[model samples]
Target: MSSPASGHPSPPRRGPRIAAISATIALFVAMIGIATSTQASAAPGCKVDYSTSNWGGGGFTGSVKITNVGDAITGGWTLRFAFPGSQTISQGWSATWAQSGTGVTATSMSWNGNLGAGASVDIGFNGTYSGTNASPTSFSLNNVTCTGQPGTTTTTTTTTTTTTPGGPGPGNRVDNPYVGAKVYVNPDWSAKAAAESGGSRISNQPTAVWLDRIAAINGTTSARGLVAHLDEAVRQAAGSTLTIQLVIYNLPGRDCSALASNGELGATEIDRYKTEYIDPIAAILGRSAYANLRIVTVVEIDSLPNLITNVSPRPTSTPNCDVMKANGNYVTGVGYALAKLGAVANVYNYIDIGHHGWLGWDDNFGPTAELLYTAANASGSTKANVHGFIANTANYGATTEPYFKVGDTVGGQPIREKAKWIDYNKYVDELSYAQAFRQRAVQAGFDSGVGMLIDTSRNGWGGTARPTGPGPTTSPDAYVDGGRIDRRIHLGNWCNQKGAGLGARPTAAPASGIDAYVWVKPPGESDGASKEIPNEEGKGFDRMCDPTYTGNARNGNSMSGALPDAPLSGAWFSAQFQELMKNAYPAL
Candidate 1:
């Protein structure tokens, strides 16, 4: 397989580069071996490096360097460090840190850093510490260096005194198993309602119409069309069952913008959703088809201000618009509705993770989690209100993934994890971010002994090549340095493409870290305009269906504008479905 492509605009240019006065200090710090402790000696085969300079404020800085110190640089590497009970990272660089009591483990960022011979790099961290700065006791690289000393070994110990925060609180919670699973069958409620009301097309040309159409038709025969897929997936896995993650994306007033249609569901509309949409689907699952299934429903609280104003059929009275702001509390009401539904059915709920370039650093996962949790909790729902969170539904293609790799590391050393948080490199190109997120989710206490899933629908064939900057003509697939054209037909236009095969499957359960890997979106669905078009594409339905008819006209042909409608022919859809079955479960 290869790296996925990115679909985000280029990052702003940096001002003239200023020479880091810290370079010499950084190098000198690298050589001194810093204050190493017994943790350094615990893993003899993996060389360890550390730093103790306080990066000002309450933040202290540290660095670690690991070398193979073994025969050869083998597979992947994992660097583990332990903080004293009194310390916690205020901010981290180069790598994502997971703390279990005093133990902190940093995994290699997504970008592959080959450690040949004695090649080494430095990964950094910033945190608040109290009491003694205990040196890390053990370092182990996956499938690479084990424990044993190199030709010659030297150890240094440094004890820096700093005030500490409250001791760690239960570490990260166990991850919810429903983190990532692809189980929706394109339930485009709006489109279906329009059709039922004798309208040829959905109002505002909504995207949910098409999704609902697909679900309505498929659900009848296949019990949401997901149960069979899950059964097949489980059968293929030798009866090792995995949860199927689904996205309940048909929220009224979905995208509140001129470019996108609204899915505004007022009290009556909400009731309709519960009765007409949610109830039937729950009933379908309640039957034998989904007896063993684990399901999560994401309200997909998209851009708040946009949805508030643009969404139709809104509440009878306008509520506070500020509440709709990103990470705002407007979702509390929605969570209440969803929680009510959860009372009758087994479902885990999540909010959106936003597309790659959409929010600031702090606005991404951390704040999103807090906001969703607050909303769910405020709705008077217990932990049962939500399962977890999800990243970009469609906007984040290949390019966006690498941009997120800015602060990842390998072997206790910093390396470009990727460029964007949800760039194509991790999704389409490499599966690194998917793996990394699973680990981070575990660290964040979201992993509940169940795994997470990544959406890889149109990303089959590893998406468009990486771009060469920002331009319309640039290759969409280009996002990272080493991504390749995936021959695996997970889903998409090339589902039946001859050379495709089933990609890797999750090796462990969520309790162990990652749970399952499944495509959240169906492939071959249009991206609103030309699949090649950029900018004009709206979120969710806008990305999947071309309301303005831009895509069909540009392609010099018109296709069906209904839910579950494929850009290709029925034969093509069948071929892709069959290919997915073959690759996902070859024996079946």
Candidate 2:
């Protein structure tokens, strides 16, 4: 939820490269054994080559080689297997990969997809291995089993670790159902909630914390920094019915066009993403103790949507954005996270779909869905991986655009009857946008069982009782006719606007197709600083936060004026927090 609205100036570069791959399968071919396809739907006569490089330290690297021996894999190929070790993928590339317990999957990358009869493509990953790293015995592509030599079989032993839960001193009581349904909260946000109390209703309002990176838990040690955070969530609950929420933000080349919340990783660091970030987080989550808690992971915000909405026909100069498109980073990253975490029973994965103002038009519907479909279908992504999607995250767009309808005609006609900017899809509100996105996603091959989530934390700003008058008139109107939803001086303003109020309270009960309404964006955390203030956190300030900086013409960030009261990217702002509570829709 860090980067706001990003608009790319060019159109998409289409067409596929029809090049043949060579000489890459030798590594797996030399050491692997053969196995037949076990998939019922697989084509006959397919075979696979499986092998593990070795196991050392706390991990080892592994690879899979699939050979299509029958009809061409015209519909694409998916390679699947079972890990015979305590192995977990930290990062995977070349194809989309996912692992749930002992099982793993890798779907073909666009360039390497569709292996011709007798042709093969190789895929591999660096995985964390605690015990024996036995090479898996079998492999299959497109569900047909591959014939190869299975690795050596061995006996195994198991171990368990336990910890006592205790916290929240005298007078602070707690109670809750642990029937394995706890939502772990980040300790940082919990402390912020406490500190913001005192005469502030926000103190009473429950909120989520932002995990923007692989933070140091105890003065720089333990890949288990996430484990430490979850530990805090457990202690804070003190056996209460209250659940915690953690926001896993921070993708390399993060908010492409925006400046404030740019992350530590670059678009090219695919290996670090696996070794340093995803693996440890997966290890902690895979533990049985944390299995019952409801761990809602807001996977890589501000990513995928950029591929469709922020790419340019003129060729983008932004290296990360360019690399992202070329390497399929966003699609791969989200698929990896979904597959990894989705393996856990209690964890819920929700990929972020940018707000209606960003990808709500007719042109956005199909591509956005296809993008989601690709990520969901990536090798490792299981049927259970992406349970739902979250929309309008971190933006201030209202839940319902009451002024427009699906077929409402404008300028004496229904849709596009006047301005070239308008259309007939009626994505005038967040809910309609979500519904339409859900349908397109299904058509694009996502499961119909998928659900939806919306970030309603800041959208409910203008109600009937509220005034279109008395707001910051000098600031740009978010909407067009009169005082509409426009937040800053123009279209696509993402900074803390001058007059925006709080929206609906967090609710498990939202409209249908929506699993629940969530505050994916923690309120009062400045989108970015007013100016570049020297700080330990690398969250830099952009001209978008300047008081007089007109706007970022290159990226179209028109929310130019500084929010006099806001702070930097992840800090708490008392004034803004108070305003949110005072202007709350349910009336804090």
Candidate 3:
């Protein structure tokens, strides 16, 4: 709920750009051999399983599975091997990859760094090779030999080619994991929705599972744990590709700008976040059972933006924000999470970039993009770890303003200047903001293939009060206010907004550079409690959720537009649910 602001209307949307599709002819070859570990105290034994697929034109994809057969690898592990041919790695996943001449080094990611005796991990890369694509004959773990022994040998090779358009080949990550994949439907939220008066209509829709605390990784008395949800997702997949959305929300000193969603960890508890929180989640996700499912993680909502917009020296700075920025725990925790979770072959990480209202302005936009690049490149993570980003998560910004343009002029003046609500922000809606942000993100050094997602859960703003046409040209304010789709008291007013309605349903590849329109925030969950009702979940009361509270620097001292009688954040508010359904845009 606490995010920054932007000014100036955005430029017009650009035409769809040409996208490249790679055709890969995969050749699956399996080989098994013993890898002797000299560093192990007891019997230093290990095994390596090597497999590869060739993409014509000298391109290939390889998969390596390492199992520790002897003593436990406590601290970390490093795998060193040499390619028999003149093979060179172009891109790698599930680990850090490097090559020196014919020699290759694959280091453990933070999540899979530790392996107990008999435990195994999967890692691979996309490479180029000449001559026969023969598998590596020898491998080493922690500087010990893993292959080329006279053990029982099993080798099999199979070749097949299938082009999925924007998808990666077998054992490789797809460009858009959502395309052609059925998303996991959470039974918990589905039950809640189906139980409501008109909830059955949208109950089956997929929403993100919020693992906001450590307890969520296992189970809470009232909710299923991460493993249970993943297992359910696997069952629902029915042997086909399915995407399970998870919100990685438990960073230390989280939501520093707002108290309602504060996490349990302390400001300096980066270690706990890594070991207790992220590590367990990663372990569960990396399990081979769920490898077939596409895992999309919305990492650490509202964390990084707070560092840029809510830290000291800014007008909206808070003490908690300052502490988080100075300690650098937010950066460390996010980076660590990205690196650990990213090591999973099927997992696709999408960092949260607060809404257009928060970072659509010039000052906040570029700096926040730079900060995202910084975090993505920190804590053993490379930019490749971040698949893409999501915008307007759990916030009420309209998806698109079809009527008035930011460049519109009224009475010989720009609408942004006269429109009180426009606030001189560069973006007027989520779609424009998301597409523009994608370009900037790529310019900031993220992969050009990165996509954008917009949260269209509660920003419909379409009821009887919905604007029908462009506003009058008498004054800028009249024209802008009359034509705007969002009816919040102010762009900063986020909570149980009274006139809010459900926006677009989830859809993949809805627009250029856009991945999907998702309901990241479930329709009925209250943003925060309307009054001071205490609980043990570390959730606190925030005035923004109160209907009577007025005036804050962030909201320009405007009255809090939240509805009355709302429950604590994440609790089911039946009244709100009915209202959302009644006001459903594109009508339920």
Candidate 4:
């Protein structure tokens, strides 16, 4: 959205900001983006995060995130801020915007009228200022003075600092390093969930610690940070060994072509990723003190998936994903990561195998498997180095669709493992897709020992709300049996959906051929900001996240059964957590 004035270029688009729900609420203003740190007081328990975009022509767009740290606002709430300069909001969306003098108030709209204890919502507006556009110095939520916050944008989490790349942890496999150890929980996520749970606490679950990037990047997990995290984890374990899963998430052009959560590396920065990100990470993991720890690395999420199917609608502007693929960066970069990380003694790696909804079809399945093998067996790596693959990394595919007929044709051909789906025994979930992928991997000459993992963090949409009969597909019994999920409009609905329940609880050795049903993406963290506020992150916004985005052909234009205006990915959304808990599959 550039309003170019003659020869003047548009100011850089604003990246996402960490919404601050700082103190009283379990929510945090966890810093994000390039901005000067300011501590502005709002309501007693709340804080306002501000970021600017397209500042030019005496006008700029500003985004403000209001969070209630004092207990859930339960009803209508208002956010008020005083501009430091001549700045005045002209208009806004996602909230009812109004102004008087230099004072402005943004009242909650009907859809976002309420929030759970630590929940926050993003609302921004285009504004005009005479000379300079300085951010508002203070803010108030519900008229109560909030905290004056000071912070900067960074993705390094405490748990991620202590986590590692690859190896077995609690899967209980014969080769698992932490055979008798419990999966180490990331304290930050646990604490946030615990503080917000209020009485419905989910006990003893493990959260994934993510090594999203290195020092060269703006995030926290560099080699030194990883060592510090590991050192601290070892201290927490006392004399016993601990198991932990670390997501090796920062691939070049991460999320490849998405508007949210894009990485520091461009699609063309392959060489930098190797020397700067991966190599140092590998050196730290090779240290001997960490030998007995169970380190499971979720290699990369959303990267390889694009090579098969562009589940996201981001290739339009950040087309570098295709360029990376053309120059072999996508393959080589991933291969380098697998090989370098795999060389570490205790490292166990799993490449992204997407989910049943994304790559379960015939057209995508084979290429992904081949891509996985090619990445695993690249020039310097052996088939033995790449341990396995993970599916549903940051996705919302149901653990089991329960009743779609196997042979249904979308066009003129049978979908998925058509013959295999007819067996009635196999369910349509990550398990089925994993089994099929494992077969494909072996065919590509990888060892048969390769396993599969599914992040059941957000897919189990249990509760009586689940459908009891057939869905709208032309295929017979697309969702016919009892207890089917019919809420999603198409194959690409990945936001924090409305009726979504907690999938499977984290566990090891759940089934044969499957590694474990893990919780890789933390339960309450967001996937992307609701569409109205604009793509703060360069990754761009997809309507799939806009709860209101009705799907079209490319997105399958399916109706997303999610509530509109969810927060950005990786931020805590108390409302969503409450929904997930109430609807948890095995019943919280």
Q: Pick the candidate with the highest lDDT.
A: 3
lDDT of 3: 0.77
The lDDT of each candidate is 0.36, 0.57, 0.77, 0.60
Each prediction's RMSD to truth: 13.1, 19.1, 16.5, 27.2
TM per candidate comes to 0.48, 0.63, 0.73, 0.63
> Using alpha carbons, what is the TM-score of model 3?
0.73
Compared with the true structure, what per-residue lDDT tens digits does model 4 show for residues 502-565?
8898877565456678888877777666764554334445565677767543343457555666
Global Cα lDDT for candidate 1? 0.36
Error of 3 at 570 (Å): 0.9
lDDT of 2 by residue, 238-331 (tens): 7653455556666667777667787778777767776677777777776775643556677777788778765654333455566677878777
- State the lDDT at 580 in candidate 1: 34
Q: Which of the predicted structures, 1 or 4, would earn the higher TM-score when compared with the native?
A: 4
Best by TM-score: 3
Model 3, span 382-480: residue lDDT tens: 888888999999888999999886656676666655567776676799987887677678668887667788888888887898999988888988887
Give residue 515's error in model 2 in angstroms: 1.1
